[model samples]
Target chain A: MGDYVFNQRHLLGLADYSAADIRHVLEQTRTFREILERPVPKVPTLRDKTIVNLFYENSTRTRISFELAQRRMGADVVNFSAATSSTKKGESLKDTIRNIGSMKIDMVVVRHESPGAAHFLTKCVPAAIINAGDGAHEHPTQALLDMYSLLVHFGRIEGLRVSIIGDITHSRVVRSNIIGLTKLGAKVTVCGPKTMMPPFVEELGVRVTYDLDEALRDCDAAMALRIQMERQDGALFPSLREYHERFGIRMRHLEQYPDFVILHPGPINRGVELQSEVADHPRALILDQVTNGLAVRMAVLYLLSGGSRV
Target chain B: MPSRLLHADDFDRTIRRFAQQFTEPYDDLSPLAIIGMQTRGVYIAKRIRDRIREFRGVEVPLGVLDITFYRDDFRSLDKVPTAKITEIPFDLDGLDIILVDDVLYTGRTVRAAMEALMSFGRPHRLRFCCMVDRGHRELPISADFVGITVPTYTTERVQVRLAELDGEDGVVVTEGA
Candidate 1:
């Protein structure tokens, strides 16, 4: 296929995409990875295109990653944090986005506190919408990047056993990864406490487990999510020490599986989901995930939004 | 529908003569860098580099440039081509560059190639070279080195096939819409 018929105008969730779509994204990302290795990594593919990062929540990492990806394609970016925006003045999401759309912005990468915020803007504005992360709905780009990191390390994602550890109820990253990784033919097991696990989470097509060690038995990879302290009201579990004892991935826990790689989406809750020692471990693909996250975003943003209209 | 312009023998002889004309004025090709446009241009560049090495007894630095991102007609295409890697391992600043392409019709490919080449760094000098210069002047651009020149109408297409890619080395003229 010489031409890229990615076929989708917006990337809302992985569930909306087919298996071929995900593979196409990963294949195109390989070429972009080569570009990243060159002396001058910047490509003028999207020059003169303006993209607005409309974030309703505080996110230093994802916002910066999307901005860097846009700059690599020579596109201009405007960051709009909710703390400094008119949304704090009680303006509606549509009203603010409609105003932004009036200025001829090409695409809007949105991170909203409510689920379906991206789909909400698709009906209101003419600009292309990319769901950075919506409430606990889906973070398609984050999961796609995680898949990229796994594909790079393991050379294949299909037929591999992957265990997602910790805070499954509140992690949008886990939701997105389950849909993508499963569609790519991976066996996924999500492990968390009863309180942190969402109701009927198995309906999302993954095995449920309360025990992390049991899930890690023969799993090729384990992704450790941060225990979102702010998302949890008081205490989802009995105590932090107890959670660390039962659920946290420590050095002793990893000694059982010799070939498993542990991954964590950053701003880590150091001694909670993973110990500081495990975070710094060589087998952990955490840092590589962060690095590949940029390339994956570039691939998605380029394929979906970097069109002729730009 | 199909007309052979240059077969494998002519292709080899033409590139050999091109190497002579290229290295004649300059005693030192150490400062020269050659880059080919994507797909077919890349294959032709490798063949030319091989011939140059045979004559000069030294390897010339080469790179591959994909101009898919820089094309002006990106939106007008029937299908948007996949983005290929634009790999320039060495820096381009203060180095003379020879850009190779398969066929030249409207000169849009050369225009896009020049824009892509400068993205790495400003070359000291840059020149275009093509295998066939089929005449249909939509833009004021010409190749510094050309293998053959054919004057044709806008309704005809100039297709270049390489043995490494298409299992044969030849040029053809085909009817276009």
Candidate 2:
């Protein structure tokens, strides 16, 4: 069982992972989930381990959830937002990371606006690196947590259909989820406007369509992508209302398929891709996704820190 | 890997004997609880709990603890150590508890276990149980119920194997391990 471990120093992307590797994380996540429900949820497993949350981008849900996962596992966590750090004073990313490594950090949980920011730090420092999110490239932990919520509902990830809707072109979550879910034997289907949908997205082994009604039907799970208006380039959709009218998941869509597990990585636009009523639907695991995020991050941090192949 | 300490027959008697003396001071097992440290300690704790039920006719609450994060020598480990899960099903407030483990050496695991236990709640009393109390004391903590004591050299390692996990039940001494 020890060899059934996450034998890696850095979690850069799901492209390097196998189905077994993802399953190792899910197995460990089951343990953390049980631990979270206990009276004293905290464990001393990572007690002496020290980690730094080095986020180059702005995030609340990702940053705070990683911080809580680290602390709940009994590790000393230091939060380092790049905006308030020496980087604003003209220090290079390498210099800042080297200086942080000089303090003898064990691991770094990083989020950056630029892709490969975490991959760059793996060579600059001795500490393990966990990519919280890197621009539009990937968000592996989000994928793992989303997969975990699905595992809780479907009892397995293999042989299930999951549809992803909204701004797939700019979504790091969609990219990572595609890699991870497909590796674990789940079929992914994506739907959005032609401009919002990336070119040749079907080449990544998913069915792509522009029809929301077709996208919403006959799937085990549905993950509504948060329309990244802040990160959108060149007005992909005409307006938010038109986008909602075309791709927005309403109560009726879920009513048609009662067993469809609903998921959304939040800072959710209630009326955008998902209707406000459907967001509150019992099938929506949006809030459960948040709760499972802690367990999944805890599993990722624990496996990366202690169960290293090195 | 060649030396044997106790077999299934002697192991069973030693546990029952320890249960008798350990419960001699208490009238009722209702307020008593059994907690095992993670890995092998949990297996030992479960057995002791079963023996207590057979002897005293009471079902004691059982808990499992993993103290990997509370170890004093985490920095000293050559490689990163995997932290085990800590599961305490019932409240630890004001109950008499017996902490169980297979082998006792260095006293560090017990000390760490005590610190982890305190985070839950203060028990009315805390007691320790060990199947083999091999003497290599780094701390003053000692077991309250000892099934057997075997003294060995620093170069050797004492291994306790249980059928539940290790595919057999026996204790062994590995020379120069």
Could you tell me every candidate's TM-score relative to the true structure?
0.92, 0.91
lDDT on C-alpha atoms for all candidate structures: 0.86, 0.86
Question: Residues B1-99, candidate 1, lDDT per residue (tens digit)?
Answer: 578889989988888887777667778888888898888888888888888899789798889988877777745554446777777778899998999
Docking class of 1: acceptable
Deviation from native of the Cα of residue A195 in model 2, angstroms: 1.9
| Global lDDT of model 1 | 0.86
- Model 1 Cα lDDT, one tens digit per residue, A116-228: 99999998877778999999999999999899999999999999999998999998999999999999999999998989999998998899999888988889999999888
The predictions' CA RMSDs to the true structure, in order, are 2.5, 2.8
Enumerate the chain B TM-scores of all models. Answer: 0.94, 0.94
TM-score of the A chain in candidate 1: the value is 0.97
Which ten-residue region of model 1 chain A has the weakest summed lDDT? A301-310
- Tens digit of per-residue lDDT, candidate 2, span B14-55: 878867866788897777888998889899888877898898
Could you give candidate 2's per-residue lDDT for residues A62-144 as a string of tens digits? Answer: 99999999999889989899889888899988998898888888899999989989899999987888999999999999999
